[model samples]
Target: MERTGTTRRRALIGAGAAVTAALSGCSSDEPGARRDAPPSVSAETLLRRRSAALSSALLGRYDAVLAAHPGLAPRLAPLRAQVALHVEALSPTGDRPRPASSPSSSSSSAGAAASPSPSSSASPSAAVPADAGAAVRELASAERSTAAAHTAALTGAPPEYARLLASVAAAGAVHVYLLTKGSR
Candidate 1:
């Protein structure tokens, strides 16, 4: 039997209401569920933390390079200072503490012992290259890698953090240039 227009309209309205009711019930009716949900950290906060960690690691590397080649202090000092600046910029509130000892202190001492003293003969067991050129190349490579990381991190960072990362990346690029120039 064919349905009347009024009957069809009524059925359609009833179906729509039923669907709406089903969807409405799908949400949690318990008030506790909303209240008990854990707070989430924002992506920007996480990115900032990661950038801060990267800056710290770079600072450690600078320390290692400096310790291994004390003679290069005059040149490397500025780069180390710049890395420290980056670390501070990345962590304006200083969330992470600086380590008491340099990351490569142990290796630096071992390398120092193996290399010739100012008044002694050179040895073969040096952990790092004895030449300043080699050290400069190593530092330049590290700076390039850091610059690339900062560039990649810019994608997810908040506006202020993005600008900071961009400035750091630019400084790192300049560092690489200066290091390369000095090595030649």
Candidate 2:
């Protein structure tokens, strides 16, 4: 099936949104968990929780990218595995609530609230990009935003979280470079 620019964009954006929601929701893995629990956890604790969420979101991003570009399977297979590693590293500590985010983080992440495309279900065809460069830009934007969140999480989190953030930041940079080159 032929995918149009708009259709591809919708899918890409949709995938990004899904990842964001998954990451944000990680702090409350248990259903019906209270948003207003006692605030005794250290910044490190909060960071781990938030990082886990971010990790989950990034995984979703990879899933979306793969879905949009089946041809990328061979190239992206290892990257996808790396994202899984991120999730595993963050999983054990991904369920604590964080302090209220600063205004800047909130604004930067506002784009995360949008809806994805409705034209298609999640599948290999969904992975195909109508224009490789445009898809890369969309993916880059999501990675950039997630990386920013990692930076914020690092400021208030522990040294371990900082290390994780550093790694994630490096990955995001790599993703941006690859996407740009791929587009070209």
Give RMSD to native, each candidate: 9.1, 24.4
Q: Which ten contiguous residues of candidate 2 have the minimum total lDDT? A: 111-120
> How do all models score by TM-score?
0.67, 0.53
After aligning candidate 1 to the native by TM-score, how far in Å is the CA of 10 from where it should be?
8.8
lDDT of 2 by residue, 48-129 (tens): 6667666666656656766666776666555555555555565434342232245354421222211121221234543535
Q: Write the per-residue lDDT of candidate 1 for residues 18-46, one digit (tens) a residue.
A: 99899877777755458567888777778
Residue pairs clashing in model 1 are none
lDDT of each model, Cα atoms only? Answer: 0.69, 0.59
Model 2 spans with C-alpha error above 4 angstroms: 1-42, 93-129, 182-184
The lowest-lDDT stretch of 10 consecutive residues in candidate 1 is 114-123
